[model samples]
Target: MTTRPRTPSRTPSRRALLRAMAALPVAALVLGEAPGLLGTALAAAPPSGSATRYTIVPFLNSDDGTVNVYQSDDATDFRLVQSSAYTPPSNRIRDASVFKHTDGYYYLTYTTHTWQDVSTTIGFARSSDRVGWTFLYDYTVPIANLSRAWAPEWFVDSDGSVNVIVSCSTTNDEWIFTPYVLKAANSALTAWSSPVALSGIGANHIDTFIVRIGSTYHAFTKNETAKYIEYATASSLTGPYTITRTGDWAGWGSYREGPALVQLDNGGWRIFFDGYGDGNYYYSDSYDTFATWSAPTALPGISGTARHFTVVKETVTGGVSITKNATRSLRSVNYTTRYWEEQSALLNLPVVTSSSATADKQAATFTVVAGLADANGYSFRDAAGNYLRHYNYRGRFDANDGTSTFAKDATFVARTGTASGAVRFESYNYPGYYLRHYNYQLRLERSDGTDLFRQDSSFVPATAWA
Candidate 1:
């Protein structure tokens, strides 16, 4: 029983859907295929630039219970690639795990229900050719001494060691599956190590996915209560890891699971996840501290069952990558205590001028002009001074703006009331967030003590930075 979101009555094809979303101000290549149609499709091919194609599995046939694959040169268009239904000697197939190994082969693992039809086990298979696969192991590992297993994510360590993280629980208690990690090698399931518990993480974490960003390993897990994703960092592939960033969890949202993360060839991370009710997957770039994300919109297609999505660098002919200029401005501010980050450099208030009014009625307005930056949202705060009302960001504070910022570089208008005092813009950048404004300070400071380019207030009506 896979849970899929409901689709809109008048859903468009992938090409039409991408074309509709292309109207937003999100950062990406904007191209025109026809009137009211826009996408990332490029006629000319290059070794590296944009995602020339998209591949999906388990296409038309939902039965045979096989994992289908599809390919699209454009984000809006897709075609079938391959499908594999590895039953692994088990009676049923449920959750599946797929990854591209360093050895240049694709590896897949799925949860298999035991003969009793109550217990679940883990199975492994590999494919050099995407179509046909060879079964590697079968029903050798019972899911962490439990009868249930789901959502397996494969991680390859620096030394060619493969690690598996999964959601598991007692077969009878289907709603209580906990997340766990296991160690293994390319050899077989008999050589796999026992499950290791992760510190500072909880059983509530579900639909988990792990990725290697630079030298650090990060984990993104869905917090059902918060209704969003949370992030954790670990020094080693498997161990006592700590949750560093918890995204918008308690807000009015749903699903937000099935994280498909792919590092673009042009040095950006594209994360695809399902929106709870929209029956469509959403892609977000320029993530802030894993706690904050730009507003998520439906992906190009309406077919919503993406238990997990995978990305592979095409080495064959017709593969091309494009250099995407990230126009997202993430303004961040660091206070003595707590931290703040902006969804985009552009926010409701981009400029703030000192006023005689007190914190209760200090009338300050800033404009975030669209088309200047690929800003999806904005946040502001008085980091240096304490006022009666300070901005709170997801239980953390010292930031404000609106719940969301403008998607494009459009000018947004905002006024600060008496409760809120001096305002600053949130800076969004890779890995870290920096404060763009302090009370009466116009310069922005990087989290690592480096200084970003700053503009003098004398030339501008209000102190601001972009």
Candidate 2:
């Protein structure tokens, strides 16, 4: 399996690295908007005033294997990264849950088989930068006549042991599913111990997701019989779990499943669940853990599209990133020795040497700023104070003329790249187009879905040379 190599000049900060776990980024899709939602506090907006960023990429159940990526500053709204962003080789990609490993790569655990099919295995895939994914071998769950293994979620315990909790159906009806744990033997999560049955969580339970708060283990699972999400707690990973609240405990009504939780920046908890019976999606908040929760609030726009899926949230400082308001150099992904340089208004790739001139370094440096068009996006300002924008799809260093067109042309969204930890800048107005080098000249071009195109468009946001 290929992975991106970290830049030697700098790595992610120690604090940032320690703060993130794969299961940490989740929920709050809707909090205070719902009528019954009371006693819950609103979280501050992120990536603008706050330091955090929220994202949810849900896969359609009908999709053969497509997974769409999303980005958001606040948990309230989300923007699609791309459609069919990544698809596994075969079967369905249902409940594609994601989390960032300590290795700095994003990993997914998914339901490989359809709900009706007698599935014996779960799907696994890993991405270096969350853009391109490489499929690993399918892991067979050790269950006799296993009808289905659905909603596999990543759980990194306090002891740092990576485990996956899955609801397994041993019956042919697929109605009775018991939660099971598969412990990873190594950091890579490739080798795992045989499935061990969860002690207290018995039959007729599915979509079991667990999170640890303080020393207590909180499990939010669905009861197929009662048609309501039940809350449980345990002192250990595999617990003699105790059900604390059951049957409309949060007033979410019946037919609620797929319970997931995310910790807000305010230290509150946001839980997302699927209102499948009503054909909608909802979220609720709890300021004091799950002891007390607000009423269910329906999620806008994503009510039907995201039936069962995964999301992510982390500090922007955690990953290899180009900081806004800071100066940085763009190093070519395919040509690491070359940097983007401005000469006579046009952008070009110039090879860097040990004896590279100071003037050349100054031309390579650009100050990263919030996008004039979309604040969540970014724009580059050069040493000469000119913004780099596309003119007739050609990249150039030109002054911002303060026009609406100029703002759109200058804005870009940095997307995770292919196997290089570098980021590719997708054009703001043109979704599939990227700033790429052709014959060493920079231009905005539409992706032809080629490896050469991905390599060409990708660039590392390196330390500023000037």
Candidate 3:
């Protein structure tokens, strides 16, 4: 195994780290004014606000048969990085996906099979810097004990709620458990909402991925006999999804599983699903939906059966990164953490904004608008540089009035911090958290504990208002 040199570690104040995590940029796609079942929360927007520049994050098996990360910036040229070990449950990770949430964490969900029975569970890990990562939560209970929830895909809504779409064939009359989306809160396996069905569409569904475009929630699932891709759209994530037998495949058993929705650079959509077989990879492209693809092309020699794949363009120190990783590890852990703040300069900082009547509110009414871009303890920062806050998803912050919910949006107090230019928010979670701008400067502990990467341009916030 090829190991990269350990990075230096210099512990920064808790406040500094919190600010870093909370500072990741948010660019809301202003869709048409419509709120129905298709009314998607802000979480479903395409990655990096671009609909072009289609890329793929491929999962590779090591020479020693461990799991590592290999990325293709252009879907054609692939390279590998010595990442964490892939301790499998059995032969290998059959199918998987690298799910990026609006809350700034990426989830790796996959299916693993052993000798006796087929089993699968969603492994939840986090990357504070979106590069180096700390494995956080792996489900104790298999998501569904049926024939196995294969290739689970994750989705986050505007309400800070998360859902997963998994494929399975159950014993309860329904032969195929039918690929459906299940809601999971934070990483709690028990906290998952009940399954929502997707059957009325097809029988052989596997590796389902859903993306919100405009007002429709589009689902991309793989069919066996047809060896073709199918799509469905609904207003809600947990939906009565309307089926569209829209597209077909190229190679035999070519388009197998793991259908990921990626936005292109020229402002369009590209479906990056896996092509199952030896020596060759399967992929299909379309600048316009409801139209025929240019045919399922081959991205050959990328990996040995690269099934589950995800793609995202993240702002990294070296340059922008398109990271891809997966899971089927034998051992894992799940933990719960919480963070609270004393409302410091970071939380109550002011931005330069002129006042308008629409911005004004009634007196003494604290309108706790929960969805601030950098509002969580994950984004906590203290001017004193002493305190640190770990903003895990379970953490929550509340204003007065008996209402509290954990999420990434900011809270607007109608009376106190609600006044324009009155609140400046900052917080940090573990890791080099996201910042809107590339110029964020701060003190951060490196891997070696003694050395640190401080005040780097990569940490800077690009948008001042953010």
Candidate 2, 218-287: lDDT as tens digits: 8888887787899888888789899989998888899777877776544467788877766667777776
**Please, what are the lDDT tens digits per residue for candidate 3 over residues 1-466?**
1121111122231113323433545101111222211112222212321211122334442222234565532333334544533544334343445544544554455555421244445554554433454544455334345655556665555454566677765534222436776777554433676666664555566667776665667777766434456777777665677776644432224435566655432223445555443334545545566354544445544535343566543322222211112111000001001011223312111122224122221110122222233221222222232222212211122322322222222221110011221121222211112111111111222111111211111121111111
The local lDDT score (0 to 100) that residue 212 gets in candidate 2 is 77
Q: Judged by TM-score, which candidate is best?
A: 2
Which has the greatest lDDT?
A: 2
What do the candidate models score in CA lDDT, each in turn? 0.42, 0.71, 0.38
Residue 172 deviation, candidate 1, in Å? 8.2
- Give candidate 3's total backbone clashes: 57
Q: What TM-score does candidate 3 get on C-alpha atoms?
A: 0.50
Worst 10 residues of 3 by lDDT: 327-336
Residue-level error in angstroms, candidate 1, position 223? 2.2
Listed in order, each prediction's TM-score against the native is 0.52, 0.59, 0.50
What is the lDDT ranking, best to worst? 2, 1, 3
Cα lDDT tens digits, model 1, 1-466, are 1111121242232223323443545310112121111112222222332224444442121332456665543232344555453444544444455655545566677656522244456667777766666777754544534755666666655444567777766644444557777776434434677776555567756667776544566777776555567778876565466886665542315546666564432224556665534556666654343544444545543355443454443423422211122222222232211112222221122332233223312223223222122222232232232111112211112222332232111211111111222222222221112223444333323222122212211111222222
Candidate 3 ranges with C-alpha deviation above 4 Å: 1-65, 83-92, 101-104, 114-116, 129-145, 158-160, 172-177, 187-190, 246-255, 277-279, 300-305, 315-466
